[model samples]
Target chain A: MDNIAGHKSGLSWVTNISVVVLVVLWLIPTVGLFVSSFRERDQISVSGWWQAPFSVELTYRTRGDGEVRPVDGGYVMEGNIFDTGEVRSSFEGGASTVSAFGDRGVAPAEYPAGTVAEIGDGETLQVNADGTYIYTSVEEPGNRGPRVYFEAETPPQFTLDNYRNVLTADGMDRAFINTLTVTIPATVIPILIAAFAAYALAWMDFPGRGLLIALVVGLLVVPLQLALVPMLNLHQRLGIGQSFLGIWLAHTGFGLPLAVYLLRNYMVGLPRDIIESAKVDGATDFQLFVKIILPLSFPALAAFAIFQFLWTWNDLLVAKVFLPSDDASKVMTVKIADDLLGSRGGDWGILATAAFVSIAVPLVVFFTMQRFLVRGLLAGSVK
Target chain B: MAPRAGFVSLKGFYMPVIVQGLLTIVIGVGGCIGYFYLSNLLLDKVIFPAKGENAGRNINRANQIRPWLFLFPAIFALGLYLVYPVVGSFWRSLYGRSPSDWVGFDNYVQLAASNEFQQAFFNNLLWVIVVPAMATFLGLLVAQLTDKLSWGNIAKSLIFMPMAISFVGASLIWKFVYANDADIGLINAIRASLGFGNPIDVMQIPFWNNFFLMVILIWIQTGFAMVILSAALRGIPEETIEAAILDGANPWQLFFRIKVPQIMGTIVVVWTTITILVLKVFDIVYTMTGGNFGTEILPSYMMDFMFRDDGRATAVAFIIMIVVLPVMIWNIVQARKEMR
Candidate 1:
């Protein structure tokens, strides 16, 4: 193909640049969120995540409260402003330095660090880059020590505290367990049920097999939104309302159309001679399905498994409607949408960490099993 | 209960859920396999023994009944979960909140008059039209651009990565990008750097915010469109392309004139698939804006009436189904044609 258009050197460069632009445009948003999840709370609020690797300068105010003693014909107070608990907690990483100092909040950075400035009544104040300050006056200092304001430049910092906080106190750990509890059975049960049905449709001489296949195709596009109210009513009547069992059954029912459709499509493509040979060897239909067809349909089965697993795990609407709303039963998607988005909407650190935690498993599954996923998509849709 | 309690005490709160999940998987898979195995065993051994007296007729009878045996569980689940619900939703939509209170067409009448429902319907129309077109176009573009590149596979994987992320997570990620604060929002930060005076709330801009929401779906679905269309592009016969090049077709003409026509069927499939998804999109609107500032789609709008007004919720559901029917029939007809 490339040889067909050999003189198009200019077009090749355009193709390379265009792909680079497209890939970056797609990857930036997720990368931004991923970087923000590790940053300190104040840092995330004050600056964009792109500046995460550089030091951030912040203004802080602390009081000089060292002992007032006689020195140089006056009274003096000496202490490191960085040693104060307020300033120490305000800076995240190790070894911050004062860039500038002042006595008033409005003019916090009036004097550069390591410089002295004269105040009224013959008093002079000096603050250094190491955060040590000298305050001297002809009269003794007041009971409430002089207020010292300075600008500090702190090193770049990243921590696991956001992840720790959300996992423990935010109940994401419980929601994670609940998601697995819903997803595994929902994913597994559908494959088994759909496989048997697909085998019967593909190999057996059934009365309405054609119509049944058509019905599955139509049902594939039917919105599950229609099932929410009626399904809930049915669950209540069956006495399984708002429980894990109820949600699992709902997911299984909803997942079946694609399951049957994909698996049956794949099964219909199997070589006829293989099945015929197995039949000649005295293999019953059940034995043929269990022993021959099921083993041979491994790629399709893996494909559908990944689909159902990702769908059930990432689903919020179904879980919200079917599962119990209690804290203990909430899945990760629901917990993030209802609780985190509601209360911690502005807390990017917690929000980013929670979203990442919920997204991590599916991403790993996707990357590892992407080949099968792509194959399944082509089979399921392209025909 | 004793085991659950001991596990909870030993491993803290999440242990019981894990144990229960394991138990469910074991019992569920084990039960399904047990049923299939036992039902067939019973048919062959007891009722239709393949030995002695009536062996030939008995085996014929068992063969006639065997397909139904294989299909029973799936049929039962599908009927209960999907088939029954579609009918039940329409039936329930005829009444008010309770079964005894009959109000025929009243729910539909109210929904027709409601401003929010009208807005949501229109917004859904916008989504259906815009999301599929944009996603399919971008996907086709990428698929074509990366078709002959050396690192095309890696490029395709990165573009496809968002498909794994849940709608809620994607919404949060985009929310950070569209944040109202100049210092935090990526868009606003860029604006601020380019000499903009004040930051604007991107989600609140009246009619255009819908496009903002649609971008998230486009970002997520383009990869799907890309993966499928990329395969379709590869499947185009090489001889046809060679002939087109020999006929002096320029690169632009080579694509639109030759390649796209060949893969038109696949492009339609990708378009309709995305259209169906856009019709049911709820989590993005629900999580990002909660249907505020004129971004309500039908699914999110229906959620507002859920539990509060069951009648109206079902009515909305039926409307969505009605909108979906034409596409549904087209898919079935195409599938039937392919089978022949």
Candidate 2:
């Protein structure tokens, strides 16, 4: 018994370790973007985002101002290694604090930041904390200045500049509002209409209910891409082309199958007794639905609402097809891809910030109402 | 008059586009609400006049008509937006680019003969196979692993976080990981640290880049699989596991022989649901590679032809529908069975 228990516990340890490893692996990509969004290109280029929380080593080279002049009885030229005037200029600029310096190419940080290291031939290199360095050598070091190797400790940096740039300059703010414009009505209208349909399917003794339910199920997997060109052509011919009204109706039509399916399933699960008793009490079907059914079906409605909201909000293809390609009408997903991701694909900060901005709302919705979201997923799929 | 003749006049009315948008919402939602409410009222009060002689008979007639009144708006929208377009696309597929040219099977022939179409068809096949299986497997694995731990919910939440992110957003996130700059891309950074020289642009490579794009979907979908399968895992009765343990079965044996057999239904559900998603996958390929370098899938391929070749685009759309039809029919069957 003891041997078996020991092996079982060992297996659990493996489980725990593997879960942690999997979670970290899953988080690494997003975390990389999250960190990269707060950093400058220079810092991002020099080191990994994992090193963001700690001090990073950086190297800088300053040109020599080697002018032959007499200083302390030797021909010498002196200047700060930072080239930005005083040593404090480097510190003030938020660069890594100089920790070590080197006079020779071999070891840049061989000497500490404040001390003077003497090479042969009356040449001495002195670097101070404020990045001011005095290189003393005879005969102007042959009209060439020594290349002072600078190694500094750059403190971890985090900034909101990327967010500011994305929101203001990259037009994400307008897209955010435009997305909201499409999402609200798209989400609400479908729920209202689908609720009626769902209620009818759930409770009403309709002849085609079985066939309608099956139709909804079959339509569930029909790729909206199939509907794209044809719908656009219809919209153009009907004069609703590239309009918000057009996109809303598109979202509504696409969202209805899942909405009706989920709501009808939830409504069907309502205790038969309550509905029967309500009907017997002389409450009309419409009145019972408005009062009893709608209230009781809040959780399901909420789940579907979140699903619709996230679907509409995170949607790119629907917006691409239905909404105008013009910037003024584009939603955040489309706008971000068009303005930032396309032209400045290499600008990690802009891309990360824009991507994060676009996803932030759905993330908030997903976390705050995750219970309903999961409920929706389970009911929507499994049934 | 045509059915959308009223909409034709509304579309031509002069107004700011935003006002027109708000008006549409008011008109559209208001129209649906008004239709259901007024239609019911009309049926009860005006058409049937339930309070007159033979009131009970009048009420019966109104009751019989109420469900249709409630269902009319939804049916109209679905027919106009979904049903009509489906039939229209099929019809459109028979004609050439201008829709005036009478082309019989020419579009399908072109789609079958084109090199890009063949690559897209096969690549889509690869995606449909690989994404669903791998995502479901990983999800089941995570669900099983996390179920044994105390902090499982947190782990699950973190793993599931990608679900909230859009495919475009996810593509961007993974783009950073697959970045060609050794200093920027996390994958390349790790590679460089291990002395792998300069970064290799993973997306530029043919064939393998398709898998790189598929990883984004698997990343997003695994959480969905985990959540559903986790619920299924918990649904397993305790007596089954206890009896297996009593029989001195190992953990692996307990999982495969006991747990898996019980949850096979949920596993299939997750697999097919993901398969449906895989068929419609566009944004990942659209944003990541734009169907270039042999990464083209059917949806992206269709999208490329959408602006130019209407027949070919519609033909591609039909091809996608054909691929999705079997699973869709299976889905409906399963749903009907569940309903029963």
Candidate 3:
């Protein structure tokens, strides 16, 4: 078409630029979180993630409390500012160079490092680039000593401690295991049940098959919200309420419509003559399904498996409503949404690391099996 | 539980949760396979034995019963899980807080009178209108723009990457983007650079804040729309495009006049699919604002009453079902038409 068309070549630059813009726009949000997860907590609070690679200048207030000595015509207090307990505790990284210093908090960076500044009350302050400072006053200093305000340039710092903290202390490790527990059986059981039902709908000569298929399609859009209260009631009555078993069953039910619909659509398109020939060769229905249809339908099965895996893994509502809220059984999405969002809302480092931890598995599954996922999406939705 | 704990101490490498998870998978899958195989074997060998003077009749009977054998577990699960809930929700909605107390339409009356319900209902309306339209339009635009590019597949995958992220995770990601601190929030940082003095809390901006929440969903779903609609675009017959080109249609005309009209069905499919998702969106609003500052939608509002008032919760659930009913019917109709 492009060879026959003249304007398309002339407009090719427009298409390329537009796509570049779209891709960048789509990639920014997730990239923001991913980058934030690696930064130190103080760095995340003090600077934007986009500025993470550059050095940051921060001001700190500390008092020189070292023993005062009587010098010629003055009293002097000398110490390394970076070695003070306040600076060591407040600063993030190991090595920091003093950029500027001042005697008053109002003008914290009034004089550059390696210079001496004179005060009106016969006092002088000097802070070198090595973080060593000297304070000389004509009058004897009080026990509090002179207050020194200095700005320092700290190098870019990143750590894996955020990941460690959430995984161990915040119960995300437990949540990760619990999510796997909920997702595995929930993803597997539906495939088995839906496969058999789909085989029956596709190959068997049964009454009400058309109506059944239509029923499945109608049930496809039934909001899972309709199931919550009633299902919880039923689960309590049946003595399976708020357990892994209960949530598994709930996910299986909620997932069935799409499983059956996608599988049935794919099965109905199988080579009819092959099925007929197998039947003519005296194969029983069960044998025929296990031996022939199931094997030939691997692509469709793989597609549905990927869909159910991603859906169940990324699910929050079903897990929240059906599973026990105890720490022992909390899934990742529930943990992140409830615990992290509530208490650690301002802790971007922990929040970002936890979110990434929960998102990592599904993303791996999605990229590795994206071909099957795409095929499943097309077959499931587009008629 | 004690034995599992003891075993955990005995074998220091094994976590009890991981052990339980592995056991569940094996048992759940094994149980399903065993049930299917045993039930089918029983139907063939015991109830309708195939080797006798009545072999033909028995075989025919078994064949008639075999389909049900394959479908029984699925039917039981579907009926128990889905079909029973719809009816049970309506029944529960008719009663008051106590199940035995009959309070017909009282919950609905109170819901109608409540200001929060009205606000949530209106917010949901805004979501239904805005989210699907923006996501679909952006998706279609990306699909069209990237179609002719050499690296189109990579571009599509990147756009679609958000589909893998859970809504809770996406909300957290967007929270950082919309943080109130100018140093941390991307939007506020840009604003500060432009000389805005104070950092505004975007989520507390009343009605307009709803659009900010909707942007997170649009960001996540645009890839889904792109994937589905891109396939639809490729499925278009090339003859129609070439004929329009020969007819001297400009690029915009070729797209709007020649291409879009052909894939309108698919566009509607993508639109309605996203609309249904928008209706059920809960995690974003719940995690981001907890439905505070007038960002309540239906699902999160129902969650508020879930434990405290069963009747009210079911009432909200029933309303959501009612809202979804038309789309459900439309989906079935489209599916039936395709079957024909």
Q: Give the top-scoring candidate (DockQ).
A: 1
DockQ of each: 0.60, 0.45, 0.57
Name model 2 segments beyond 4 Å from true. Answer: A1-8, A56-90, A93-130, A133-153, B1-30
| Top candidate (TM-score) | 1
Error of 2 at A287 (Å): 0.6
Taking the tens digit of each residue's C-alpha lDDT, what string does model 1 give over B1-340? 2122123333356766677778878887899899999999999999898888899999998888889899999899988888888899999899998866889999999989999999999999999999999999999999999999999999999999999999999999998899998767999999999999899999999999999999999999999999999999999999998998888778898899999999999999999999999988799999989999999999999899888888889999999999999999999999889878
What DockQ does candidate 1 score? 0.60
lDDT (Cα, tens digit) per residue for candidate 2, span B1-340: 1122133233223234445556666876797777777777778789998786789998888787888877777777777777777788888999998979989889999889999999999999999999999999999999999996889999999999999999989999898889888777888888988999878989999889999999999999999999999999999998888877778887788889999999999899899999989888789998888888889999889889877888888899888888889988888888889878
Model 2's CAPRI class is acceptable
The alpha-carbon deviation from the true structure for residue A130 of candidate 2, after best TM-score superposition, in angstroms, is 5.7
What DockQ score does model 3 reach against the true complex?
Answer: 0.57
* lDDT per residue as tens, model 3, B1-340: 2122223333224366566667767777798789889998998899999998999999999989898988988889998888988999999999999899899999999999999999999999999999999999999998898888899999999999999999999999998789999878889999999999999999999899999999999999999999998998999998989898888888889899988998899899899999999888799999999999999999999999988889999999999989989988888887778878
Q: Going through the candidates in order, state the TM-score of chain A alone for each one.
A: 0.93, 0.82, 0.91
lDDT: worst 10-residue window of model 3 chain B? B1-10
Clashing pairs in 3: none
Error of 3 at B3 (Å): 14
Residue-level lDDT tens digits of model 2 in A109-175: 8888889789678788888876676777665467567667778777777779889998878767777
Looking at candidate 1, what is the lDDT of residue B70? 91
Summarize candidate 1's per-residue lDDT along A207-319 as a digit string, tens digits: 88889999899999989999999999888777777778788889999999999999999999999999999999999988899999999999999999999999999999999
Candidate 3 residues A1-383, lDDT tens each?
76566776668888888898889988888889999999988788889999999988888898887778999998998888987767777554575899999888899999999998896699898999989888899998777777889999878888899999998899888788778877888888888889999999988887988888888988888889889989988888877767777887888899898999989889999999998999999988888888988898888889988888788888888888887676677789999999988887789999999999999999999899899899999998846
